[model samples]
Target: MRTRTARHAAVVAALLLTLGAPDVAAAPAPPPPDAAGTADAESAGAALVARRAALAAASRGGGASGLDFGACPAVEDLPSRVRCATLRVPLDYARPDGPQIFLTVSRAAATGARGAARQGALVQNPGGPGASGMHFPLVADLPGWERIAAAYDLVGYAPRGVGRSAPLSCRDPAARATGPVQEPVRPSPAYKMQRLAQARAYARGCARRAGAALPYYTTPNNARDLHVLRAALGEEKLTFLGASYGTYLGAVYATLYPRHVRRMVLDSAVDPDPRRVWYRNNLDQARGFEGRWRDFRAWVARHHSVYGLGTTPEAVQAGYERVRDAVARTPAGGTVGTGELRSAYLQAAYYDDVWPDRAAALAAFLRGDPSVLAAQAAPDPAAAAGAENATAVYTAVLCNDAPWPADWGTWDRDNTELARTAPFETWANAFLNLPCASWAVRAGRSPVAVGAQPERLPRTLVVAAERDGATPYAGAQELQRRLGAGASLVTETGAGSHGVVGGRNGCVDRHVERYLLTGGRPGGAGPPGAADYRALRAPRRWFVAPRLVAVHGEDVGSEESALGVS
Candidate 1:
């Protein structure tokens, strides 16, 4: 394996060459010597307490801001008792009074506790740079989080350039959003060119549609807006729960406003190393996904008695390749492409809960049924629209935050090189972000130095699944290190799920719930020399098909099982 130092140096060099400027921010200073580190840890802990006290003193007797609360717009997933409202913030912080954009924010007020007992707001984000998190307050509805909901008002929002908050669009809303099957690559120069063209066209569309607001839709600005949301909600100190890309946002918020963080839970952390902000991060994801994909292949092989695809991992790969080749040769039902098939299976890599269904789909298709594959690829009009917007916002944020390799050659070279080793979805993901090479706006800003002032941060709980592809475990480790002695990592060992906290892992949830509720942390829960916790289990939901609805084994009425498994 390549050393992190070597990887860092290589990526930085590529970034400099491509951007024609130094975009990689310097990493924070190394950890102190053991004896000094111990002293520093003690002093940092003392400093944190004093800082919290000072902040509390400064904001004594402060109450809610004047922002009016109204009933949230009803959505399918949101529970009752949720309130929402819109707030306006500057489009660009540089010129605060220049232009204004609105943000939609939601909150589920504490139900378990009253005034003095309530623990302020517990804000959360659900990862997408493009994904809308307006319903994240729904975390309050989870099994172990009800108490947390009672103590802290669960807050959620649609960050700038996502959802109803000045949404970014790169296509004509009236134009049919073609849900084409853009498959994984095979090192073909022609396919490479097609992706480049598509990316360039996409870039052009964003430039024409996104207009001047494009440049400001960045991570730093997003962090600043979060602070504004904090003020609007009248929270003196922030208690954050962020997952996936959200982990990065929360980290940046802490970096800029460390004094304001009361508590933070970063689940499935993004690498804080500035050099890997995005370009390198995607490459890392390709490798990370490869490992999980193998796990999935192994699982399917174990269940060969049912699916009959293969009896071993290597055999499973052969089956997968055959299925992939079929999709490419003839788009399933003229709708699904090899790309769409690969994309669908990619979900299984993120979370194994989909494994049974995904494998079943493959089995059905291999048996001469294209309906299963075609249905999966078919686009729901509204979902497709939302996906398009997300792609737009995702592009804007990453491109604006840092410089990507300027030339198509760099992308082609890098991705093609990566596909050789990690072939699953390398080309698919590569083409997805290829627009960055031709982005409309250039913020010329480097990603924030998240760990620059480690001492100022509170004792944050950073969680990760050891085998998470989206936000790999190594990134979480790096994050904990940068967070200095105050941070304790709680990694779910051998678990490949992207985000695991509320996904039904008791051990992980116990640690998270205890921390969010009783100010607990996860130290000493890990094996010696490992992370603070080593979660060993994964969630598996297998609903055996039943012909009758039973009330404690007494049949009330006959009902067909939704899942086909009998």
Candidate 2:
């Protein structure tokens, strides 16, 4: 996922065009890396040395025995049942004895009467390409989560370069302190040049600090690491739950190790098209989010008595624009600028549950109170290092997983054209991924071809919201089609939240629970709509105020925050 500052700007002219044009030609593959000289051989040698050092560090407490489980450090509100451990896997699978990296794994033991006969570990990932899953097991307390835990151990792990694992850091503290903080809106020729320079500098910093490890940070590698974790946990087959980018990772894992999968659930599935990898997905997201924002406007209009913004969607939108213009001219609370205002409201596109908070913030801003807006605009600086690490990992994985166009001309031409229709996030999304144009590492492999071969894979359940702005509903449909009969798609009709399961949607949760427990697939399947299932309604409070804070930290322009492309 791209950051908010880097992923939410727009091109005004493009906003006037039609939405949903047919697919464009796929991006051309990048040229192969230098492979004909001593330079190549020397580069290979250096990489091997670094890998060895990483392996040595990972081997500190255990040698080849896998993870060493123990009590986790006291995390204030983390569940008491959660246990933490670290597992070492080769940084490069081909070199088993080469460098190794540790993955921080957390587990919630099954608590049902059939605990001893538990199905196996259900590994979970919350996406972000960078989001940490260390606390995911704590969700066992949620309605459906406990049932899932009853059937199997809930396992969550921070992928190789995230959280308590051997994290990847690219930004020098000093550089980050002084670098450009926000992307320019409707970038001018000069702004584009400046962005290009920043992109190059960011790429160079990553290479300088983590180049040796960057190649190994691809999704394919992460999948391989998953298999290693599976083995370490003594599981014969992997049962998994992944959301957003996690869905993409799950797809890759299933494709590579089909028979190893037992039961899998992918929420907010990503389109597995190599061409769309990161860039095209963001374009799709721009259109999707615009639709979602319109939905928010309509919702706000319906409650005009409470908000007093407007009694019509257009009027509400105009009110928002007035505020946006004000911020552009003079920031709110001397901190929330035009960009921050956009970022603050962008969450409304992700989940409607936060609408009230967003509504309250907007009303407060209009009432001359910018505190909430300022808080959303400027995140706690103490969290900057962690946020940078997540961004670094996000960039490394995306840029290295598949070949991104190296030619600036391709990006310029494509984004310029896309801006014509999907204006809201076009420029920002382009800048979010701009670093790939000057990425220092060559892609480790071609994009994984994810398709279901039912004969080799087990039944899988795919969940998506009908109006998910980030991953978009179309990607879920495409993923279901690609996975063929091996997959069953469940859609939350009329809903726009990015992550659907475990959000107190009894209708969606029931299908998920049945699939994970009894392996009983939903019958008469076309695309099971959330409205079809009749069960208890989710608590009113759920939709009123879901946790606004993202699982990892400030998501900014990231897919986790806005696009769900991670």
Candidate 3:
């Protein structure tokens, strides 16, 4: 997922409202219909209450796991690695004794030298509903990560619907269609109609492809699975560090199993509200992009001579519109069409580290050279496989977790209004989520009311970016508000990326490292609004800002002008 250019517009989109809703009241679950539904709810409820009781009992007596690392498995293909037995859990908590699902578990032996077994096992997930965590011990090559990994017998698991665990694959023709893109959204009826149809089709396609499994793939269910994994690992209490969506998972775990937690770190946190899910979150994300866009515009204005688009920001914007209109009508090689533009634009928005390269690529393309832009824009086939799997699971779980408006008209009305204010990813994101329209399975419980104030919880660390478009900093504010004395929020003043874990802002990075290593969370309350926020150190300089500006919005930086053709 690495790229050289800023694709400033792309980053603006990716960084868009990354934070979750602050008021995380769980959606109301349907009232228990029959005795079976009632009984099942009670059982699930009992299991949760029992788990909490066990955690309390364990704390009083000793810890959760009584067994120590007795005998190690013989080393094989990957020496220093050992596979533990899978933890069997219900595919449907409603039928706890019915079809069973196995949770895959893997770990590296604690490095015996240097008194490295500092704490117990450190369980980690590398984000992505699709990213494989089974090999995290060997793959996480971060500078100081090894010390912790060596000492903690780093552990990882494949969540129910991904990797080595049972997976959901989508083979529908509708699912295979590339989603449409709409930016600087217009008032055309055609654009609106196409967007509505696409969303419904995508939801239906997933429901058909991923059957019964869809209902059980929710964040709360995943939290329950974590407890079962804890039992198998024989760890009395679980220690965790999650990034991006992983942060949302971690937050759910804390809320559901408050006592079983030994310690937790949520970086680039996701909001916990079910209603907001991915839909409303994208709206807040649009604003985040606007902020980064303004930052980029100022930077581009300063370096106008180098880019040569224009001297003032307004002129630079005119330049971008010219390229966008020209490319829409006549793309380079014809093959590199709007779809590729959309994908390339999305790729560029993922990081602040490469904005300059993206600007250069656009400038080159306008001047009749597309080699650099093509090289960066083309999709990686191997990564695409993982993207497909992750996206399918993401859709299935999201669609089943709650009912999106079945009425396309309602969606049309909502989106039309959204386009007026936040046109950046509104329509494009709506198309991406088209699958929910016809999801095969019925909806599950929406989130119930979550605590408005912090209660019994352990000290936790939260990392948030001021201008993150994906998970906005606002959710972090809510999380900080609820966490009270038990948590600390570290604001990355100048950066805009998802999750502050290891993306390389030293201030945020050091704060996260310290918390993970010594349970040290920096104390600070960030500014109230996104615009009022500041960067931790000097804001990191970016070259890719211009291209990112394209996807996020025209608000970031004015677009580059096309050079006159000979």
Candidate 4:
């Protein structure tokens, strides 16, 4: 579900929109002020407490009853390590005592310098809404995670319906295209019919396979589950580091259970407004991709001799358009279609480290190299299996949590408007989500509207970048305005990328680490404007190299600053 914005260091910041539940029907009531100080924090913490009791009750006796692990698991005759266990919760929170599912949990105890242990467990989530956090303590060395690892028994677990946890699987392989081959033909009966068919098939297939568990996969349930995990871990308060969707999860948890929170960090946040979750978030991602595209175009323009893309940004863009047009007319090898090309592009848009490789791949494909495009189209069995499970869970949770407009007319209008600007991904994205229109379950409670009001709660630190496209910088600003005194937003200037930590901005990481260790939030709360931020230029962009996709263009790259992570 992650969306690539700009090529920042490989920081975890992708904004992914997963499909699962139906629309929310009832909006939760806003909490009283003097509850939690600051609007954003107050709203978040309030929402959290409201669901704690219900979620806690659901955690007992569904499928994972009476399961517990005290210490790290020792797979071999090896040193003592983190422990692993399971906790059962209802598949549907509405029926807390009904059919239950097991959620996987893992913990790594602290081992500090001189053998001194850190205080509480610092739980971390990698933000796939699909990624596994079970190995967080093991894999936390990625870029900028070491600071927190030193002082806490790092903890993480897969959200229900995800990895290691009992998963939901999509049976249809046809649904797993790298991208959509079907394009919208304006005023065409065939296109409309095809859209309806694809939408219905995806929805029905998911409902048939996912069943009742769909209703229970919302973020609220996950927040509630964390409390059970907190209790099971013997910690009175929880500390957290959640990036991307994990940040949303963290925000929900804080909103629901203020007292249970010791310290928290929400990086690359989401729409605090529940109703706009799908709409605005997707728009943000589109803009991010466009911005990155422009950046790439400019970079390519500078190397005209090498790329043969003309010595201007406009020319580079024209060259890319030609490639896209070719892809649309004739799918590479008549099999590696335009859909595959778009998917490759989308993946490249995710990080700074892979920009060069993706650029190279696209270049090759444009240059008539069928194998390059074919390779992009090829699917790996393991990845496909994981994708099937991930997609099923994502769909089940999204469609079941809240209802989507079943009306094709509304979608048609919305997509038409969206495509006017975001032509690159608009239709393809619409097709990708066509299933939501026909999902089986009806909608649930509508998301609550949290107003800005201060109350009693621990001070929290929020991190975001100025140029961030996926989770726009404005979200952080609004969140800060809402939180007021109790929260602070540390704007990571110019740094771009999602889901990556500690790679691009030392200042940002130091700020986060200071807060985690000492409970201090960002200082010098500046006015919400462009002037308040600074830039942290990334050293690279991550993704597969772009193949030579254009027939008449020369190879690009060969620049000192061309797509390498520092």
lDDT of 3 by residue, 192-294 (tens): 6766666565566566766767677776667667665665555655788776777767776666555556667776666656556655665566556555554
**Against the unseen true structure, what C-alpha lDDT does each candidate score?**
0.69, 0.68, 0.56, 0.58
Residues 1-566, candidate 4: write the lDDT tens digits: 43322211122222211101111112132342222332477564654454433455643332133446656444211123657777776554444556767778776666574554576788776675666666555534444555566677777787887866877665765456654363432426577677779678777777777666555566666766776666656666678877776776666666655555666777776656666655556666677766656656666666666656678878866766666677677766565455566666665455545556555655676677757656665445447777777777766655654557788887788877876776666676666666777777664434423322223335566776555555766666665444434555666554445543454455567777777766654443343221223333333333312211001111122211111213
User: What's the candidate order when arranged by decreasing lDDT?
Assistant: 1, 2, 4, 3
- Which prediction has more favorable TM-score, 2 or 4? 2
What is every candidate's alpha-carbon RMSD to the true fold?
A: 14.0, 11.2, 11.6, 11.0
Q: Estimate each model's TM-score.
A: 0.81, 0.80, 0.76, 0.77
Residues forming the 10-long window of minimal summed lDDT in candidate 2:
16-25
lDDT of model number 1: 0.69
- Top lDDT hit: 1
Q: Which ten residues in a row are the worst by lDDT in model 1?
A: 545-554
TM-score between candidate 3 and the true structure: 0.76
